[model samples]
Target: MLVPNDHVDQTGSQASAVRDADAVVRRCRERCDQTVAANEVTEAHWVARITAIAKDEDKSAFAEVFRHFAPRVKAFLIKSGADESLAEECMQDVMATLWQKAHMYDAARASVATWIFTIARNRKIDLIRKNARPEPEDLPWGPEEQPDQADVLALQQDSARLTDAIRQLPEKQRRLIERAYFGDLTHSEIAAETGLPLGTIKSRIRLALERLRHSMS
Candidate 1:
């Protein structure tokens, strides 16, 4: 028996709807695949650029990387609560570190963008800490004018007392204090040099300073 005309039209409409849905799904898959391939190529290109700098100290490659990443890093820092000047400064340092530490990058581990942004983040943290507690002023050794003999003797005696107090500190605290005050290293630099945590370095130095103050008083 032949199907009714309306039933035939209904079946045809259902099939058409299914076909339309399949076509839409196929187009979406195609676009997504194309996008993934494009992204992979872009990532590979950046990796190669970084590798070129690492292997050959390639200035041109570095310049290209700097151009692409500098503005992006600055904008990222700004978004992360850095002011314009601080962001600009941190961006410069991040790019410089990227060039300096390109050999440390592992493409297998992270993308070039990831590696660079990580550096930017660390630098920002370091800068924030550095600014939060400005370095202590240097000991007043030389005055603008020639000091009287009595004044010179008093200064020398004060210097001697400070030296004795620093010598009395615990070895770990003493070393950190010397590096931070005498060697003119920032806490981050000390952390990098000594492979110690930043918090530990700060704590030791603070305790050392407190002891010195008590001794001097």
Candidate 2:
């Protein structure tokens, strides 16, 4: 079958266009697959890296976690009203706790980021508590009688229980308690920083304290 030359040329051009389209489709599929794989790898990579640090005390693995999280945790503390030095100190404390307590992590409960940030938030709370506590030198020991052993023990137990109760509160309630008792923020200041209503802030703090008291009792 003798075909026209122009017809042959047109057929060849159409064949070329089809091949080009197939190539484009293949490239798009490959990219989509890569993206899916990358997404799947991300969480596992963080978990494995953290597990490596926990099992082997691998400095290299810890270095990677620190590289990714420390600056972020520090910035979070600063945003939460800590001074620069306090923020840096809290960051260091958070990383130290992670190193020491990595064995306690449950991957089923939280992602690596959530776990680390929670520790960072708690460390900030501890820093606020430490700064607010009166130093030994500042305590008025006027005629400090040797306390009864039973009284001292009861007081210590109550203090420990209160601390645990505070820790068990929901994060929002805990933050309000921390700001009210530990930080210098007024209710209005916390309201402004949190974008919550002032009444809500007061209500949460009041409710949190009531819970703590009930728990301690």
Candidate 3:
């Protein structure tokens, strides 16, 4: 039976449309798969870097983490209302904790960023409490908890990493981190002194930390 010409033309157009749609679907699937694979590779790279530091006492590996995390940790402290100098002190303590406690890190449980940030958050609170204490003359003399040998060693290791990492930051971010660490002014006080909005200060600090994490990693 001879098909009508219009019928044949319509059938061909429908088939062509179907093929075009299929092609688009295949390309999208391929792109999605590639993206997933790339993400997995990046995750593994960070996990391996941190694991090396834990198992080998690898300064290079620790440097990688420090370069990425220390500045950001300082930024977080500043955001949480620490003075720059106190924040810096707390940031250093937090990094030392990371080095010493690297062995405790489990990629299965948390990402490196999460672990470091938690330490920073806790240390910031501790510093506030410590500073709130009355002067020596106001309080009775009593024994304080002595730092352990391992902590001392970990802090010693952090000196080099901290120095190098700070240099690698952008000038503004570096200064922000330093001020957050060393400036006597509290975050609110600093805002008042500098005449900058509190939200702007926090946002800049947050962005700096995120950039540091991405680039250093």
Candidate 4:
């Protein structure tokens, strides 16, 4: 949601149309007040600009994309039950993918915001799986690697704050979230485990995530 709602990362637009879209978007501000209009904050405008910037290989533009969406993405991860350290790691991976695959975004297929969000959502799910339940068998997976010196220090500091924050979540939320993210389960899985309705499980998870995100911040 933080990225510009433009299709800058998309392709296949005619040259004139692209130029016009860029020009009109830049004039999105209220010239009278020299400020962006409230309505201009819609997702489409940001998508185009971000897509364009990404394709241009402009470092600042890419950095801007990171600055805009990183926090929200991280918050989503943490709310979904990833510890802060894991959320940060997931965020780094997600952004790296965005930069590497920006050209994969096609406006005709999906709006930029939705596409990026899907990436973040998938990455968050993966992070949760990595930390959640044990594997079925002692599979061929490798042993856990030692943390980097800097990473070790950061984890020690960050995990404390994150754990405390999670402990403060409502009991209903804390339990369901633990199952969903930390247990690598989904809403349906939680519902089946608890004998709750599908809707109730989803609502509880959604509310829990939102509350935890706010409380943590």
Candidate 4 residues lying further than 4 Å off, grouped into runs, are: 1-15, 18-42, 130-217
Going through the candidates in the order shown, the clash numbers are 0, 0, 8, 19
Q: Give the alpha carbon lDDT tens digit for every residue of 97-189 in model 3.
A: 988877665443344665676677567656667754232221111133222222222222222233444566678766665465444447675
C-alpha lDDT (0 to 100) for residue 38 of candidate 1? 39
- Greater lDDT among 3 and 4 belongs to 3
Q: Give every collision pair in model 3.
A: 84-179, 84-180, 84-181, 84-182, 85-181, 85-182, 85-183, 88-181
Model 4 TM-score on a 0 to 1 scale: 0.45
Span of 10 residues, lowest total lDDT, candidate 2: 138-147
Error of 4 at 100 (Å): 0.9
Local distance difference test, each candidate? 0.56, 0.54, 0.52, 0.51
> What is the per-residue lDDT of model 2 for residues 88-167, given as tens digits with 9 covering 90 to 100?
88889899999997765544334576678778766766665775433233211123222222222222222333444556
Q: Taking the tens digit of each residue's C-alpha lDDT, what string does model 4 give over 1-217?
A: 2124243443454233445444544543233121222223333444445555645766777777788788977876777677889889888898888888776554333334455777787676555467643423321112222112222222222222334445666788668765564446755676544333334324433453444345446
Over 4 Å off, model 3? 1-40, 130-217
In model 4, the Cα lDDT at residue 189 comes to 70
